[model samples]
Target: MFGTKVIETFKEEHTGDVLDMMRDFEVKKRAISEEKEGNIVLRIPAAFAETYKSLNSNPISKHIFKGRFTETTKLKRDKLNINVGVSKQFIARSVSNNIEHAKRILAENECSNISTILLVGGFAESEIVQERIREAFPNKRVIIPSESGCPQRSSSSWS
Candidate 1:
Protein backbone atom coordinates (compact mmCIF):
# COMPACT_ATOMS: atom_id res chain seq x y z
CA MET A 1 0.00 0.00 0.00
CA PHE A 2 1.15 3.57 -0.70
CA GLY A 3 0.32 4.57 2.88
CA THR A 4 2.48 1.71 4.17
CA LYS A 5 5.37 2.86 1.97
CA VAL A 6 4.98 6.43 3.30
CA ILE A 7 4.97 5.25 6.91
CA GLU A 8 8.02 3.07 6.31
CA THR A 9 9.81 5.97 4.67
CA PHE A 10 9.02 8.23 7.67
CA LYS A 11 10.22 5.65 10.16
CA GLU A 12 13.42 5.06 8.17
CA GLU A 13 14.08 8.80 8.03
CA HIS A 14 13.84 9.12 11.84
CA THR A 15 15.48 5.85 12.87
CA GLY A 16 18.25 7.27 15.09
CA ASP A 17 16.55 10.46 16.28
CA VAL A 18 15.33 10.85 19.86
CA LEU A 19 11.90 11.89 18.58
CA ASP A 20 10.04 11.80 15.27
CA MET A 21 10.01 15.63 15.35
CA MET A 22 11.12 18.48 17.56
CA ARG A 23 9.21 19.04 20.81
CA ASP A 24 9.51 21.97 23.19
CA PHE A 25 12.87 22.84 24.74
CA GLU A 26 11.81 21.42 28.11
CA VAL A 27 11.21 18.03 26.53
CA LYS A 28 14.52 18.18 24.64
CA LYS A 29 16.39 19.19 27.82
CA ARG A 30 14.98 16.24 29.78
CA ALA A 31 15.73 13.82 26.95
CA ILE A 32 19.34 15.02 26.67
CA SER A 33 20.11 15.19 30.39
CA GLU A 34 18.63 11.80 31.38
CA GLU A 35 20.31 9.85 28.60
CA LYS A 36 22.47 7.23 30.33
CA GLU A 37 24.21 5.89 27.17
CA GLY A 38 25.81 9.37 26.67
CA ASN A 39 27.00 9.28 23.04
CA ILE A 40 23.96 10.35 21.06
CA VAL A 41 23.85 13.97 19.86
CA LEU A 42 20.72 15.97 19.01
CA ARG A 43 21.03 18.99 16.76
CA ILE A 44 18.39 21.42 17.94
CA PRO A 45 16.88 23.42 15.15
CA ALA A 46 17.25 27.19 14.75
CA ALA A 47 13.49 27.59 14.45
CA PHE A 48 12.92 25.59 17.66
CA ALA A 49 12.06 28.73 19.65
CA GLU A 50 9.82 30.15 16.95
CA THR A 51 7.36 27.37 17.53
CA TYR A 52 6.74 28.58 21.11
CA LYS A 53 5.39 31.87 19.82
CA SER A 54 3.66 30.58 16.68
CA LEU A 55 0.13 30.46 18.12
CA ASN A 56 -1.42 33.87 17.78
CA SER A 57 -3.38 35.46 20.65
CA ASN A 58 -6.82 35.61 19.06
CA PRO A 59 -9.55 36.54 21.61
CA ILE A 60 -11.85 33.81 20.24
CA SER A 61 -9.20 31.07 20.65
CA LYS A 62 -7.82 32.49 23.94
CA HIS A 63 -10.55 31.07 26.20
CA ILE A 64 -10.32 27.53 24.78
CA PHE A 65 -6.51 27.58 24.49
CA LYS A 66 -5.69 29.11 27.90
CA GLY A 67 -4.18 26.02 29.50
CA ARG A 68 -4.44 23.51 26.68
CA PHE A 69 -1.25 24.10 24.72
CA THR A 70 0.50 20.72 24.74
CA GLU A 71 3.43 21.96 22.67
CA THR A 72 3.14 18.90 20.42
CA THR A 73 3.61 20.50 17.03
CA LYS A 74 5.63 18.42 14.58
CA LEU A 75 8.17 20.33 12.54
CA LYS A 76 10.69 19.26 9.92
CA ARG A 77 14.13 18.41 11.25
CA ASP A 78 16.86 20.96 10.62
CA LYS A 79 20.63 20.72 10.14
CA LEU A 80 21.21 23.80 12.34
CA ASN A 81 24.01 23.72 14.90
CA ILE A 82 22.96 23.38 18.57
CA ASN A 83 24.93 22.75 21.71
CA VAL A 84 23.71 21.30 25.03
CA GLY A 85 25.78 20.86 28.16
CA VAL A 86 25.05 19.30 31.56
CA SER A 87 27.45 20.03 34.38
CA LYS A 88 28.08 18.11 37.60
CA GLN A 89 29.12 21.42 39.15
CA PHE A 90 25.49 22.53 38.93
CA ILE A 91 24.39 19.88 41.44
CA ALA A 92 27.57 19.40 43.45
CA ARG A 93 26.97 22.15 46.01
CA SER A 94 23.35 21.14 46.61
CA VAL A 95 24.31 17.48 47.07
CA SER A 96 27.04 18.44 49.48
CA ASN A 97 24.60 20.50 51.56
CA ASN A 98 22.10 17.63 51.52
CA ILE A 99 24.78 15.26 52.77
CA GLU A 100 25.68 17.65 55.56
CA HIS A 101 22.02 18.06 56.55
CA ALA A 102 21.64 14.31 56.60
CA LYS A 103 24.61 14.11 58.93
CA ARG A 104 23.01 16.66 61.24
CA ILE A 105 19.76 14.72 61.28
CA LEU A 106 21.59 11.55 62.18
CA ALA A 107 23.34 13.35 65.04
CA GLU A 108 19.99 13.94 66.77
CA ASN A 109 19.38 11.88 69.96
CA GLU A 110 16.37 10.08 68.50
CA CYS A 111 18.30 9.10 65.34
CA SER A 112 21.55 8.09 67.08
CA ASN A 113 20.77 4.37 66.84
CA ILE A 114 19.42 4.49 63.30
CA SER A 115 21.45 2.16 61.09
CA THR A 116 19.51 2.38 57.83
CA ILE A 117 19.39 5.32 55.45
CA LEU A 118 16.56 5.31 52.92
CA LEU A 119 16.94 7.63 49.94
CA VAL A 120 13.87 8.42 47.87
CA GLY A 121 12.66 10.80 45.10
CA GLY A 122 14.18 11.92 41.80
CA PHE A 123 17.53 12.87 43.33
CA ALA A 124 18.00 9.35 44.68
CA GLU A 125 17.66 8.01 41.13
CA SER A 126 21.02 9.51 40.23
CA GLU A 127 23.94 7.08 40.53
CA ILE A 128 26.30 9.86 41.52
CA VAL A 129 23.97 11.00 44.31
CA GLN A 130 23.56 7.42 45.53
CA GLU A 131 27.33 6.93 45.50
CA ARG A 132 27.80 10.14 47.50
CA ILE A 133 25.24 9.02 50.09
CA ARG A 134 26.89 5.59 50.38
CA GLU A 135 30.25 7.23 50.81
CA ALA A 136 28.89 9.59 53.47
CA PHE A 137 27.40 6.78 55.53
CA PRO A 138 29.54 3.72 54.94
CA ASN A 139 28.56 1.97 58.19
CA LYS A 140 24.83 2.41 57.67
CA ARG A 141 22.69 0.38 55.29
CA VAL A 142 21.67 2.48 52.30
CA ILE A 143 18.51 1.64 50.40
CA ILE A 144 17.40 3.10 47.08
CA PRO A 145 13.98 2.16 45.83
CA SER A 146 13.61 1.03 42.21
CA GLU A 147 10.69 3.41 41.76
CA SER A 148 12.02 6.51 43.47
CA GLY A 149 9.33 8.75 41.95
CA CYS A 150 6.48 6.77 43.51
CA PRO A 151 5.58 7.11 47.17
CA GLN A 152 6.05 3.88 49.15
CA ARG A 153 3.37 2.70 51.57
CA SER A 154 4.43 1.53 55.02
CA SER A 155 3.54 -2.02 56.14
CA SER A 156 1.34 -0.50 58.86
CA SER A 157 -0.82 1.12 56.19
CA TRP A 158 -1.91 -2.29 54.85
CA SER A 159 -3.67 -3.18 58.10
Candidate 2:
Protein backbone atom coordinates (compact mmCIF):
# COMPACT_ATOMS: atom_id res chain seq x y z
CA MET A 1 0.00 0.00 0.00
CA PHE A 2 2.87 2.39 0.65
CA GLY A 3 4.47 1.91 -2.76
CA THR A 4 3.25 3.49 -5.96
CA LYS A 5 2.68 0.07 -7.50
CA VAL A 6 1.48 -3.31 -6.28
CA ILE A 7 3.90 -5.29 -4.07
CA GLU A 8 4.48 -8.04 -6.64
CA THR A 9 5.04 -5.41 -9.34
CA PHE A 10 7.54 -3.62 -7.15
CA LYS A 11 9.45 -6.82 -6.37
CA GLU A 12 9.45 -7.84 -10.02
CA GLU A 13 10.75 -4.46 -11.05
CA HIS A 14 13.21 -3.66 -8.27
CA THR A 15 14.33 -6.78 -6.41
CA GLY A 16 16.53 -8.20 -9.20
CA ASP A 17 18.46 -4.96 -9.57
CA VAL A 18 18.54 -4.32 -5.85
CA LEU A 19 20.03 -7.72 -5.12
CA ASP A 20 22.44 -7.78 -8.09
CA MET A 21 24.04 -4.49 -7.19
CA MET A 22 24.48 -5.65 -3.60
CA ARG A 23 26.28 -8.75 -4.83
CA ASP A 24 28.60 -6.78 -7.07
CA PHE A 25 29.98 -4.43 -4.38
CA GLU A 26 30.54 -7.24 -1.88
CA VAL A 27 32.82 -9.00 -4.34
CA LYS A 28 34.53 -5.97 -5.85
CA LYS A 29 35.54 -3.73 -2.91
CA ARG A 30 37.95 -6.27 -1.41
CA ALA A 31 39.99 -6.10 -4.63
CA ILE A 32 40.17 -2.29 -4.93
CA SER A 33 43.71 -1.25 -5.71
CA GLU A 34 46.00 1.51 -6.96
CA GLU A 35 46.28 -0.16 -10.38
CA LYS A 36 42.53 -0.44 -10.70
CA GLU A 37 40.31 2.60 -10.26
CA GLY A 38 37.05 1.08 -9.10
CA ASN A 39 33.75 2.80 -8.53
CA ILE A 40 33.08 4.04 -4.97
CA VAL A 41 30.09 2.32 -3.43
CA LEU A 42 27.70 2.24 -0.45
CA ARG A 43 25.44 -0.68 0.35
CA ILE A 44 21.76 -0.61 -0.53
CA PRO A 45 20.48 -0.16 3.01
CA ALA A 46 18.10 -2.61 4.64
CA ALA A 47 15.41 0.05 4.59
CA PHE A 48 15.45 -0.18 0.83
CA ALA A 49 13.30 -3.27 1.08
CA GLU A 50 10.78 -1.30 3.10
CA THR A 51 10.45 1.63 0.73
CA TYR A 52 12.19 3.11 -2.30
CA LYS A 53 11.81 6.61 -0.89
CA SER A 54 13.59 5.82 2.39
CA LEU A 55 17.06 6.77 1.17
CA ASN A 56 15.91 10.27 0.25
CA SER A 57 14.89 10.87 3.82
CA ASN A 58 17.83 9.34 5.65
CA PRO A 59 21.07 11.31 5.67
CA ILE A 60 23.65 9.63 7.89
CA SER A 61 22.75 6.09 6.77
CA LYS A 62 21.80 6.65 3.14
CA HIS A 63 24.63 6.68 0.59
CA ILE A 64 22.99 7.20 -2.80
CA PHE A 65 22.28 10.66 -4.01
CA LYS A 66 21.48 12.15 -7.43
CA GLY A 67 21.75 8.94 -9.46
CA ARG A 68 25.38 8.27 -8.50
CA PHE A 69 25.27 4.71 -7.10
CA THR A 70 26.38 1.70 -9.20
CA GLU A 71 26.50 -1.52 -7.10
CA THR A 72 25.71 -2.86 -3.63
CA THR A 73 27.33 -4.95 -0.89
CA LYS A 74 25.39 -6.95 1.66
CA LEU A 75 28.46 -8.98 2.51
CA LYS A 76 27.59 -8.87 6.18
CA ARG A 77 24.45 -10.54 7.36
CA ASP A 78 22.99 -7.29 8.69
CA LYS A 79 24.66 -4.60 6.61
CA LEU A 80 24.05 -2.80 3.31
CA ASN A 81 26.51 -1.38 0.74
CA ILE A 82 26.34 0.47 -2.57
CA ASN A 83 28.91 0.90 -5.34
CA VAL A 84 29.95 4.43 -6.25
CA GLY A 85 31.92 5.92 -9.16
CA VAL A 86 33.76 8.79 -7.57
CA SER A 87 36.20 10.86 -9.63
CA LYS A 88 39.89 10.11 -9.24
CA GLN A 89 40.63 13.78 -9.00
CA PHE A 90 38.17 14.03 -6.14
CA ILE A 91 39.94 11.30 -4.23
CA ALA A 92 43.23 13.07 -4.75
CA ARG A 93 41.83 16.35 -3.52
CA SER A 94 40.29 14.74 -0.46
CA VAL A 95 43.53 13.00 0.41
CA SER A 96 45.37 16.24 -0.09
CA ASN A 97 43.03 18.03 2.26
CA ASN A 98 43.45 15.42 4.96
CA ILE A 99 47.21 15.46 4.58
CA GLU A 100 47.27 19.23 4.79
CA HIS A 101 45.19 19.16 7.93
CA ALA A 102 47.44 16.61 9.58
CA LYS A 103 50.52 18.61 8.66
CA ARG A 104 48.98 21.74 10.08
CA ILE A 105 48.27 19.96 13.34
CA LEU A 106 51.80 18.61 13.46
CA ALA A 107 53.25 22.03 12.81
CA GLU A 108 51.10 23.54 15.51
CA ASN A 109 52.43 20.91 17.88
CA GLU A 110 56.03 21.80 16.89
CA CYS A 111 56.56 18.54 15.03
CA SER A 112 57.12 20.13 11.64
CA ASN A 113 60.27 18.06 11.20
CA ILE A 114 58.51 14.74 11.63
CA SER A 115 59.59 12.26 8.96
CA THR A 116 57.14 9.37 8.98
CA ILE A 117 53.35 9.26 8.66
CA LEU A 118 51.22 6.40 9.84
CA LEU A 119 47.70 6.15 8.46
CA VAL A 120 45.70 4.21 11.03
CA GLY A 121 42.01 4.91 10.52
CA GLY A 122 39.64 2.72 8.55
CA PHE A 123 40.32 5.00 5.60
CA ALA A 124 43.94 3.99 5.92
CA GLU A 125 42.97 0.58 4.52
CA SER A 126 42.09 2.16 1.19
CA GLU A 127 44.54 1.61 -1.66
CA ILE A 128 43.65 5.00 -3.08
CA VAL A 129 44.53 6.69 0.18
CA GLN A 130 47.73 4.69 0.42
CA GLU A 131 48.66 5.62 -3.13
CA ARG A 132 47.94 9.28 -2.53
CA ILE A 133 50.01 9.29 0.64
CA ARG A 134 52.94 7.77 -1.22
CA GLU A 135 52.61 10.26 -4.06
CA ALA A 136 52.09 13.28 -1.87
CA PHE A 137 54.83 12.50 0.60
CA PRO A 138 57.51 11.12 -1.65
CA ASN A 139 60.17 12.29 0.82
CA LYS A 140 58.51 10.81 3.89
CA ARG A 141 57.87 7.24 4.99
CA VAL A 142 54.23 6.18 5.20
CA ILE A 143 53.21 3.21 7.31
CA ILE A 144 49.91 1.38 7.05
CA PRO A 145 49.00 -1.90 8.71
CA SER A 146 47.22 -4.55 6.69
CA GLU A 147 44.14 -4.81 8.90
CA SER A 148 41.04 -2.63 8.71
CA GLY A 149 40.58 -0.14 11.54
CA CYS A 150 36.99 -1.02 12.37
CA PRO A 151 36.36 -4.45 10.92
CA GLN A 152 33.06 -5.03 12.64
CA ARG A 153 31.30 -1.82 11.64
CA SER A 154 28.53 -2.08 9.11
CA SER A 155 28.14 -0.21 5.77
CA SER A 156 29.69 2.81 4.05
CA SER A 157 33.07 3.69 2.51
CA TRP A 158 35.07 6.88 1.94
CA SER A 159 34.50 8.00 -1.64
Candidate 3:
Protein backbone atom coordinates (compact mmCIF):
# COMPACT_ATOMS: atom_id res chain seq x y z
CA MET A 1 0.00 0.00 0.00
CA PHE A 2 2.42 2.67 -1.18
CA GLY A 3 0.71 4.97 -3.64
CA THR A 4 -2.98 4.59 -2.94
CA LYS A 5 -5.67 2.06 -2.24
CA VAL A 6 -5.95 1.13 -5.89
CA ILE A 7 -2.26 0.57 -6.30
CA GLU A 8 -2.04 -1.35 -3.07
CA THR A 9 -4.81 -3.67 -4.17
CA PHE A 10 -3.22 -4.10 -7.55
CA LYS A 11 0.08 -4.99 -6.02
CA GLU A 12 -1.59 -7.57 -3.83
CA GLU A 13 -2.52 -9.54 -6.88
CA HIS A 14 0.47 -11.80 -7.28
CA THR A 15 -0.17 -12.22 -11.01
CA GLY A 16 0.67 -8.61 -12.03
CA ASP A 17 -1.67 -8.66 -15.00
CA VAL A 18 -2.35 -4.95 -15.25
CA LEU A 19 1.29 -4.00 -15.05
CA ASP A 20 2.06 -6.40 -17.82
CA MET A 21 -0.60 -4.94 -20.11
CA MET A 22 0.74 -1.45 -19.65
CA ARG A 23 4.29 -2.58 -20.35
CA ASP A 24 3.10 -4.40 -23.43
CA PHE A 25 1.65 -1.15 -24.68
CA GLU A 26 4.94 0.57 -24.01
CA VAL A 27 6.78 -2.06 -26.00
CA LYS A 28 4.37 -1.68 -28.90
CA LYS A 29 4.55 2.09 -28.60
CA ARG A 30 8.32 1.91 -28.39
CA ALA A 31 8.16 4.29 -25.49
CA ILE A 32 10.81 2.06 -24.00
CA SER A 33 13.48 0.86 -26.39
CA GLU A 34 14.23 -2.83 -26.67
CA GLU A 35 17.88 -3.74 -27.29
CA LYS A 36 17.47 -7.50 -27.49
CA GLU A 37 15.83 -7.23 -30.94
CA GLY A 38 13.13 -9.76 -30.20
CA ASN A 39 9.66 -10.05 -28.73
CA ILE A 40 10.48 -9.81 -25.06
CA VAL A 41 8.40 -10.13 -21.95
CA LEU A 42 9.38 -9.62 -18.29
CA ARG A 43 7.86 -10.15 -14.87
CA ILE A 44 9.05 -8.64 -11.62
CA PRO A 45 7.51 -8.48 -8.18
CA ALA A 46 5.31 -5.50 -7.56
CA ALA A 47 6.49 -3.49 -4.61
CA PHE A 48 3.79 -3.12 -2.03
CA ALA A 49 3.99 -1.78 1.49
CA GLU A 50 3.65 -5.29 2.80
CA THR A 51 6.35 -6.57 0.49
CA TYR A 52 8.75 -3.93 1.78
CA LYS A 53 7.87 -4.81 5.30
CA SER A 54 8.66 -8.43 4.59
CA LEU A 55 11.90 -7.52 2.87
CA ASN A 56 12.94 -5.51 5.87
CA SER A 57 12.82 -8.64 7.99
CA ASN A 58 14.91 -10.72 5.62
CA PRO A 59 18.65 -11.35 5.92
CA ILE A 60 19.08 -9.48 2.63
CA SER A 61 18.13 -6.34 4.54
CA LYS A 62 21.42 -6.65 6.38
CA HIS A 63 23.22 -6.19 3.09
CA ILE A 64 20.76 -3.56 1.88
CA PHE A 65 21.21 -1.44 4.99
CA LYS A 66 24.93 -1.58 4.37
CA GLY A 67 24.32 -0.14 0.87
CA ARG A 68 24.84 -3.48 -0.77
CA PHE A 69 21.70 -4.70 -2.50
CA THR A 70 21.88 -7.98 -4.30
CA GLU A 71 19.60 -8.74 -7.22
CA THR A 72 19.33 -12.02 -9.04
CA THR A 73 19.08 -11.65 -12.79
CA LYS A 74 17.78 -14.73 -14.51
CA LEU A 75 18.46 -15.02 -18.21
CA LYS A 76 16.71 -17.85 -19.99
CA ARG A 77 19.16 -18.86 -22.66
CA ASP A 78 19.47 -22.35 -24.13
CA LYS A 79 19.54 -23.20 -20.42
CA LEU A 80 18.50 -21.29 -17.33
CA ASN A 81 21.22 -19.02 -16.13
CA ILE A 82 21.19 -16.86 -13.02
CA ASN A 83 23.60 -14.09 -12.07
CA VAL A 84 23.70 -12.13 -8.87
CA GLY A 85 25.01 -8.56 -8.46
CA VAL A 86 25.44 -6.38 -5.42
CA SER A 87 24.50 -2.74 -5.83
CA LYS A 88 25.93 0.23 -4.01
CA GLN A 89 22.44 0.98 -2.68
CA PHE A 90 19.07 -0.59 -2.23
CA ILE A 91 17.04 -0.80 -5.42
CA ALA A 92 13.60 -1.21 -3.80
CA ARG A 93 13.72 2.12 -1.99
CA SER A 94 12.44 4.36 -4.78
CA VAL A 95 12.11 4.28 -8.57
CA SER A 96 15.22 6.30 -9.33
CA ASN A 97 17.12 4.72 -6.50
CA ASN A 98 16.32 1.22 -7.73
CA ILE A 99 17.37 1.94 -11.29
CA GLU A 100 20.59 3.61 -10.23
CA HIS A 101 21.56 0.75 -7.99
CA ALA A 102 20.62 -1.77 -10.63
CA LYS A 103 22.89 0.04 -13.07
CA ARG A 104 25.81 0.06 -10.72
CA ILE A 105 25.41 -3.57 -9.87
CA LEU A 106 24.99 -4.58 -13.48
CA ALA A 107 28.00 -2.55 -14.56
CA GLU A 108 30.16 -4.26 -12.00
CA ASN A 109 29.04 -7.77 -12.85
CA GLU A 110 27.54 -7.89 -16.35
CA CYS A 111 30.83 -8.53 -18.08
CA SER A 112 31.72 -11.42 -15.85
CA ASN A 113 28.28 -12.84 -15.09
CA ILE A 114 25.40 -11.89 -17.37
CA SER A 115 24.83 -11.05 -21.03
CA THR A 116 21.64 -8.96 -20.67
CA ILE A 117 19.39 -7.39 -18.07
CA LEU A 118 15.64 -7.47 -18.14
CA LEU A 119 13.82 -4.50 -16.69
CA VAL A 120 10.33 -5.22 -15.46
CA GLY A 121 7.82 -4.53 -12.72
CA GLY A 122 6.18 -1.14 -12.15
CA PHE A 123 9.30 0.98 -11.81
CA ALA A 124 10.78 -0.31 -15.05
CA GLU A 125 8.63 2.07 -17.11
CA SER A 126 10.43 5.25 -16.12
CA GLU A 127 12.75 6.46 -18.90
CA ILE A 128 15.17 8.03 -16.48
CA VAL A 129 14.91 4.78 -14.54
CA GLN A 130 16.05 2.45 -17.29
CA GLU A 131 18.57 4.98 -18.64
CA ARG A 132 20.63 4.82 -15.50
CA ILE A 133 20.63 1.06 -15.72
CA ARG A 134 21.67 1.16 -19.38
CA GLU A 135 24.35 3.80 -18.97
CA ALA A 136 26.03 1.88 -16.21
CA PHE A 137 26.01 -1.45 -18.02
CA PRO A 138 26.38 -0.47 -21.64
CA ASN A 139 28.20 -3.62 -22.62
CA LYS A 140 25.44 -5.88 -21.35
CA ARG A 141 22.25 -6.02 -23.40
CA VAL A 142 19.02 -4.65 -21.90
CA ILE A 143 15.54 -5.72 -22.79
CA ILE A 144 12.08 -4.72 -21.61
CA PRO A 145 9.58 -7.20 -22.89
CA SER A 146 6.10 -6.57 -24.25
CA GLU A 147 3.87 -7.66 -21.40
CA SER A 148 0.13 -8.03 -21.86
CA GLY A 149 -1.05 -9.45 -18.58
CA CYS A 150 1.11 -10.88 -15.87
CA PRO A 151 4.72 -9.64 -15.94
CA GLN A 152 6.00 -13.09 -16.87
CA ARG A 153 7.61 -13.26 -20.31
CA SER A 154 9.95 -15.49 -22.23
CA SER A 155 13.53 -15.75 -20.96
CA SER A 156 14.94 -15.92 -24.50
CA SER A 157 15.75 -12.20 -24.69
CA TRP A 158 18.83 -12.66 -22.59
CA SER A 159 20.41 -14.97 -25.11
Candidate 4:
Protein backbone atom coordinates (compact mmCIF):
# COMPACT_ATOMS: atom_id res chain seq x y z
CA MET A 1 0.00 0.00 0.00
CA PHE A 2 0.94 3.67 -0.36
CA GLY A 3 1.08 4.12 3.41
CA THR A 4 3.58 1.27 3.72
CA LYS A 5 5.88 2.92 1.19
CA VAL A 6 5.63 6.22 3.00
CA ILE A 7 6.56 4.63 6.29
CA GLU A 8 9.43 2.78 4.64
CA THR A 9 10.72 5.98 3.13
CA PHE A 10 10.41 7.79 6.43
CA LYS A 11 12.35 5.07 8.24
CA GLU A 12 15.06 4.93 5.59
CA GLU A 13 15.52 8.70 5.30
CA HIS A 14 14.24 10.69 8.27
CA THR A 15 14.21 8.24 11.17
CA GLY A 16 17.79 7.13 10.62
CA ASP A 17 19.01 10.73 10.58
CA VAL A 18 17.25 11.58 13.84
CA LEU A 19 18.52 8.44 15.54
CA ASP A 20 22.01 9.18 14.28
CA MET A 21 21.85 12.59 15.98
CA MET A 22 21.12 10.86 19.30
CA ARG A 23 23.86 8.28 18.74
CA ASP A 24 26.50 10.25 20.66
CA PHE A 25 24.30 10.43 23.75
CA GLU A 26 24.88 6.66 24.29
CA VAL A 27 21.17 5.99 23.82
CA LYS A 28 21.42 2.23 24.33
CA LYS A 29 17.68 1.92 24.95
CA ARG A 30 15.17 2.45 22.16
CA ALA A 31 11.56 1.58 21.50
CA ILE A 32 9.45 1.95 18.38
CA SER A 33 5.76 1.47 17.79
CA GLU A 34 3.31 2.06 14.98
CA GLU A 35 0.32 4.31 15.58
CA LYS A 36 -3.09 4.06 13.99
CA GLU A 37 -2.67 7.19 11.89
CA GLY A 38 0.25 5.87 9.87
CA ASN A 39 2.63 7.39 12.36
CA ILE A 40 5.74 5.79 13.80
CA VAL A 41 6.60 6.42 17.43
CA LEU A 42 10.09 6.67 18.86
CA ARG A 43 10.65 6.78 22.57
CA ILE A 44 13.88 8.11 24.00
CA PRO A 45 15.32 7.58 27.47
CA ALA A 46 14.26 10.42 29.79
CA ALA A 47 12.28 11.09 32.94
CA PHE A 48 9.56 12.70 30.83
CA ALA A 49 8.13 9.32 29.82
CA GLU A 50 7.58 8.24 33.43
CA THR A 51 5.96 11.56 34.30
CA TYR A 52 3.73 11.30 31.27
CA LYS A 53 2.54 7.88 32.42
CA SER A 54 1.79 9.25 35.87
CA LEU A 55 -0.09 12.24 34.45
CA ASN A 56 -2.27 9.82 32.50
CA SER A 57 -3.19 7.86 35.65
CA ASN A 58 -3.73 10.91 37.86
CA PRO A 59 -6.04 13.66 36.63
CA ILE A 60 -4.95 16.09 39.34
CA SER A 61 -1.39 16.13 37.95
CA LYS A 62 -2.53 16.96 34.43
CA HIS A 63 -0.18 19.27 32.57
CA ILE A 64 -1.25 22.11 30.29
CA PHE A 65 0.49 20.65 27.29
CA LYS A 66 -0.01 17.00 26.49
CA GLY A 67 3.61 16.41 25.48
CA ARG A 68 5.47 19.12 27.36
CA PHE A 69 6.25 18.43 30.98
CA THR A 70 7.39 15.31 32.84
CA GLU A 71 8.08 15.58 36.54
CA THR A 72 10.33 13.20 38.44
CA THR A 73 11.44 12.92 42.05
CA LYS A 74 14.58 11.21 43.31
CA LEU A 75 15.97 10.63 46.75
CA LYS A 76 19.59 11.41 47.48
CA ARG A 77 21.04 10.74 50.90
CA ASP A 78 17.51 10.84 52.37
CA LYS A 79 16.75 14.12 50.57
CA LEU A 80 13.90 14.22 48.08
CA ASN A 81 14.58 16.24 44.93
CA ILE A 82 12.14 16.89 42.14
CA ASN A 83 12.97 17.60 38.49
CA VAL A 84 10.40 18.92 36.05
CA GLY A 85 10.65 19.23 32.29
CA VAL A 86 10.69 22.77 30.84
CA SER A 87 11.67 22.04 27.28
CA LYS A 88 8.28 22.01 25.60
CA GLN A 89 6.85 25.31 24.28
CA PHE A 90 3.96 25.68 26.70
CA ILE A 91 6.12 24.95 29.74
CA ALA A 92 9.00 27.05 28.44
CA ARG A 93 7.20 30.26 29.36
CA SER A 94 7.10 29.19 33.00
CA VAL A 95 10.72 28.14 33.50
CA SER A 96 11.16 30.44 36.46
CA ASN A 97 7.95 29.16 38.05
CA ASN A 98 9.12 25.58 37.55
CA ILE A 99 12.45 26.37 39.20
CA GLU A 100 10.56 27.89 42.14
CA HIS A 101 8.40 24.81 42.34
CA ALA A 102 11.50 22.65 42.47
CA LYS A 103 13.00 24.73 45.24
CA ARG A 104 9.74 24.58 47.23
CA ILE A 105 9.61 20.81 46.83
CA LEU A 106 13.19 20.49 48.04
CA ALA A 107 12.41 22.70 50.99
CA GLU A 108 9.21 20.85 51.88
CA ASN A 109 11.11 17.55 51.95
CA GLU A 110 13.45 19.04 54.59
CA CYS A 111 16.46 18.15 52.40
CA SER A 112 19.00 20.67 53.59
CA ASN A 113 21.66 18.10 52.84
CA ILE A 114 20.83 17.94 49.17
CA SER A 115 23.78 17.98 46.82
CA THR A 116 23.45 19.16 43.21
CA ILE A 117 20.52 20.31 41.07
CA LEU A 118 20.35 18.64 37.68
CA LEU A 119 18.77 20.14 34.55
CA VAL A 120 18.10 17.85 31.65
CA GLY A 121 16.14 17.94 28.37
CA GLY A 122 16.34 20.51 25.57
CA PHE A 123 15.39 23.60 27.61
CA ALA A 124 18.35 22.97 29.84
CA GLU A 125 20.54 23.93 26.88
CA SER A 126 19.13 27.43 26.59
CA GLU A 127 21.39 30.21 27.80
CA ILE A 128 18.48 32.26 29.12
CA VAL A 129 17.08 29.33 31.09
CA GLN A 130 20.49 28.48 32.52
CA GLU A 131 21.14 32.08 33.51
CA ARG A 132 17.77 32.34 35.21
CA ILE A 133 18.40 29.15 37.16
CA ARG A 134 21.86 30.33 38.15
CA GLU A 135 20.43 33.62 39.36
CA ALA A 136 17.79 31.82 41.41
CA PHE A 137 20.07 29.19 42.96
CA PRO A 138 23.43 30.85 43.08
CA ASN A 139 24.84 28.45 45.68
CA LYS A 140 23.39 25.20 44.34
CA ARG A 141 25.39 23.17 41.87
CA VAL A 142 23.56 22.79 38.57
CA ILE A 143 24.60 19.87 36.40
CA ILE A 144 23.99 19.55 32.68
CA PRO A 145 25.21 16.75 30.49
CA SER A 146 27.99 17.47 27.97
CA GLU A 147 27.19 14.98 25.23
CA SER A 148 23.57 16.00 24.77
CA GLY A 149 23.91 15.90 20.96
CA CYS A 150 22.57 18.30 18.32
CA PRO A 151 19.73 18.33 15.83
CA GLN A 152 20.38 16.70 12.46
CA ARG A 153 19.74 17.93 8.95
CA SER A 154 19.88 16.10 5.64
CA SER A 155 23.42 15.96 4.26
CA SER A 156 22.70 14.05 1.08
CA SER A 157 22.20 17.20 -0.94
CA TRP A 158 25.70 18.40 -0.16
CA SER A 159 27.27 15.74 -2.24
Among all windows of ten consecutive residues in candidate 2, which has the lowest summed lDDT?
Answer: 69-78
Order of candidate numbers by TM-score, starting with the best? 2, 1, 4, 3
Candidate 4 lDDT over residue span 44-131, tens digit each: 2223323334435533223232232223333333222323222222234567688879788778758777768887755566555666
lDDT of 2 by residue, 1-159 (tens): 123443444456677756765465534543456566434544444444444444234332333333332333222333443233343445567778998987677677588688999888656776778887888778888998767554554455532
Best candidate according to lDDT = 2
User: Model 1, range 18-123, lDDT digits (tens) per residue?
Assistant: 2434333323433333234322244433333222224222221122222212221112244221323232433456679999999999999999999999898666
Give the TM-score (vs. native) of candidate 1: 0.46
Clashes of each: 0, 13, 4, 0
Best by TM-score: 2
Model 3 residue 10 CA deviation in Å? 17
Cα RMSD of all models vs. native, in order, equals: 14.2, 11.3, 16.3, 17.7
* Alpha carbon deviation, residue 96, candidate 2 (Å): 2.3
Better TM-score candidate (1, 2) = 2
Global lDDT scores for all candidate models = 0.52, 0.57, 0.46, 0.46
